[model samples]
Target: MTVDPRAALDRLIASLEAHYNAVAGRQSEDDPAVDDAYDILADAFEVYDEALGTAHGEALPFYLAEEDDDEDDEDDEWGPEGDDSYGDGADVEDLAGEARSS
Candidate 1:
């Protein structure tokens, strides 16, 4: 069944409000309400994005970062214990300079 994009957008806006309220009223650092609201917000965004794309061939300006299962591979690429592959004191400017030279 196709979802109505307008309704989906309303749901997404409501979810955003709920998430903001959850964060504002959070009781502690590890508040479950905030986490629950965040999950709901993510779901609502996905639903709205999909409905909008399907209905109007349009999409939101931003997207949620998807969780990946290849975390171990990422860790390996960064070296043991998540150490960066870059040498000590390396920065973006240095990388940009090297790229320009090459």
Candidate 2:
């Protein structure tokens, strides 16, 4: 099922407006209305991005950040002893030695 990019863009704009309204009229710090609006806005944005890419071979300049991972876990990939695995098979230590000798 293909979506019209223009329509998706309109929906995305409306969702943004709704989110702004929800935040502006917040009842409390933990307002469910704001949360719901944010969710809707996120969904609309994803749909619009997909539709725009599919229809015009172009994409938005930015992307929504994923919320799945814990902030502290970001550096786990580097590990306690940082291993440089440059996919091109360049030895980082050898490069550093060459730079120092130069």
Candidate 3:
């Protein structure tokens, strides 16, 4: 299967976040491993963010709301290409057409 970089990044971030949360319960504030995870997460996140910047000429969101993810296909809503919607975008043409038809 072809790997969608953005989707892969999303999954990785989620996994890392969960790992951090779990380790948080088991580790004290002074633990070096806890600090290491933060460093690793930051480095991994930088790769994802850099890929987003290089691939799309924009900063992809680090996280999205659960409700928004379910509202439409992530591929449809945030496809890596031909999806021009970023900040301040709402597909006015589509919206207007839908409104008129309704």
User: In model 3, where do residues sit more than 4 Å from their true spots?
Assistant: 1-4, 7-11, 60-102
| Candidates 1 and 3, the one with greater TM-score | 1
Worst 10 residues of 1 by lDDT: 74-83
| TM per prediction | 0.69, 0.69, 0.43
**What is the number of residue pairs that collide in model 3?**
0
For residues 54-74, write the lDDT of model 2, one tens digit per residue.
999899999997784653453
lDDT of 3 at 70: 43
Q: Which ten residues in a row have the lowest lDDT in candidate 3?
A: 63-72
Instruction: Encode model 3's per-residue lDDT on 1-102: one tens digit a residue.
Output: 343568759866875985677576656667777667666766666667666667767676564334444445555554334465532365657668779999
* C-alpha local distance difference test of each model: 0.85, 0.85, 0.63
Pairs that clash in candidate 2? none
Q: Where does the lowest 10-residue lDDT sum fall in candidate 2?
A: 71-80
Q: At residue 39, give the lDDT of candidate 3.
A: 64
TM-score of 2: 0.69
